[model samples]
Target: MIDSQLSRAEDPELAVQVQRLHQLKVCTRWLGVIISWLVVIPFVTWQLQEEIALMRDHFTLAAVRYALIFNPISAIAISWCLGLTTAVLLWQSGNILFGFSSRYRHQLEKQVRRIRRRGKSHVFWRWVIGSKNQ
Candidate 1:
């Protein structure tokens, strides 16, 4: 679909802008999937409970006490750690991987604004809803 659009574009600058927008959209989508997995994997796993049981069985009182004290703190710590990791990775990818400097970001924003005013609702809603259906 984007290929057709790019092929049909009369302006070279517009073609490049569209290509960049498509690349950024793809990056946003994959980043969302990666971050969701990072945020969800730890809490969703059964391994933690098994490990807690192992500690209780092996180390008895000391492990149980430490585990009880540490569980909540660890959950909070893990959440913050994952969040910061996500932010850092996103920044790194934007800067290094995607070459998305602030200037290109502003250009993308302006292009999106232009699209919005042109009655193209898909541009605004695509990232929010993760849908291509218009």
Candidate 2:
């Protein structure tokens, strides 16, 4: 079914439709990510407030200080990790959802390999001298 859809995209009208569908899917995926964060942020904040009140009532001053300070620091560190992970996952999902063909991937890999083979000096000199193709 997917292969037939891909082949049908060779037609201009079908290609346009395929592109629109891909865009809609990408948009919906991001909307899902946004909606999830919206629901999670408030729930997490509520839980944190309840936990903090418990900490203040029960723990020692030193313990409370540690919790107060470290809690946010740790939350920030964890949030950063989660955000990075989400970003990478979302990007990959977008690529997959938008039909980044394996042929393009292989071509990109070949280009990268060729550049790596040229070495740093060759690339640098090419840029410095404004040369196109060695």
Candidate 3:
């Protein structure tokens, strides 16, 4: 997408808008990742502590085994869920606040339509670009 946008860099106005949108997207994505990790680390730690405490008396290989196996999986799932949710929310809020070019809006609406076609079962269906219906 950036590549396609850059190709139109000859148009100064478009170039600037694309640059601004790109920067916003990048910042929001990283912020989402950081927020996800911040939440996941402590939550996962507390979960592990609680599980270990509960199994302290009858501590067996199975408890440790399951923790080792499931913790990472759960952590990854939770992180992706939180990260994507945060990113989408932040992106939409930014769009509402700053607005975007018609080209960008069209692209976003196209993406939202594709996601919507995937049905409500799609992970991002709920947050699929807010400007879509507009």
Candidate 4:
């Protein structure tokens, strides 16, 4: 599935993401894991105290966007917006980072292919074996 170039600095394929590299299914699975851990967990554990804490934290901003002056429904709504915003931010930045790394992988792939084409196979094999040392 890994059709992109990977850098020597950090080939996820060479490490944690090795087996799952370049697979849409892997992304989906990972996203599902994150959502379960982050969104569902806290939501399920939610209580009235936590809701009040949320209202207290955003008390200043409420004056501007809301006028009802704090209720259970408003507290829940504010907390949800905060959680959703954090998730969306993470997703967007993660996407950008992956896009950049994919490009880097493509560049590395081209470089490797170029060397393989121009350099003799025996030479490459010798280099891999560390010359006389190995």
lDDT of each: 0.58, 0.55, 0.62, 0.47
Which pairs in model 4 have colliding backbones? 5-105, 5-106, 6-105, 13-18
Clashes of each: 0, 0, 0, 4
Q: Give per-residue CA lDDT, model 4, range 22-134, as digits (tens).
A: 34333655676566457544543453445446667776555433432434454565566567657756765775676536554454445444534555553432332223333
- Which candidate comes out best when scored by TM-score? 2
In order of appearance, the predictions have TM-scores of: 0.34, 0.41, 0.40, 0.25
Show the lowest summed lDDT stretch of 10 residues, model 2: 124-133
Which scores better on lDDT, 2 or 3?
A: 3
Name the TM-score of candidate 3. 0.40
Instruction: Tell me each candidate's RMSD, in Å, in order.
Output: 10.9, 14.4, 11.0, 13.2
Over 4 Å off, model 4 = 2-70, 100-134
Q: Candidate 1 residues 6-46, lDDT tens each?
A: 53364444444545565666677667757766766566344
Candidate closer to the true structure by lDDT (higher is better), 2 or 4: 2
Better by lDDT, candidate 3 or 1:
3
lDDT of 3 by residue, 27-126 (tens): 7677777777787767766768866785787788888767767778665756576767776778778767987666775565455446557766656544
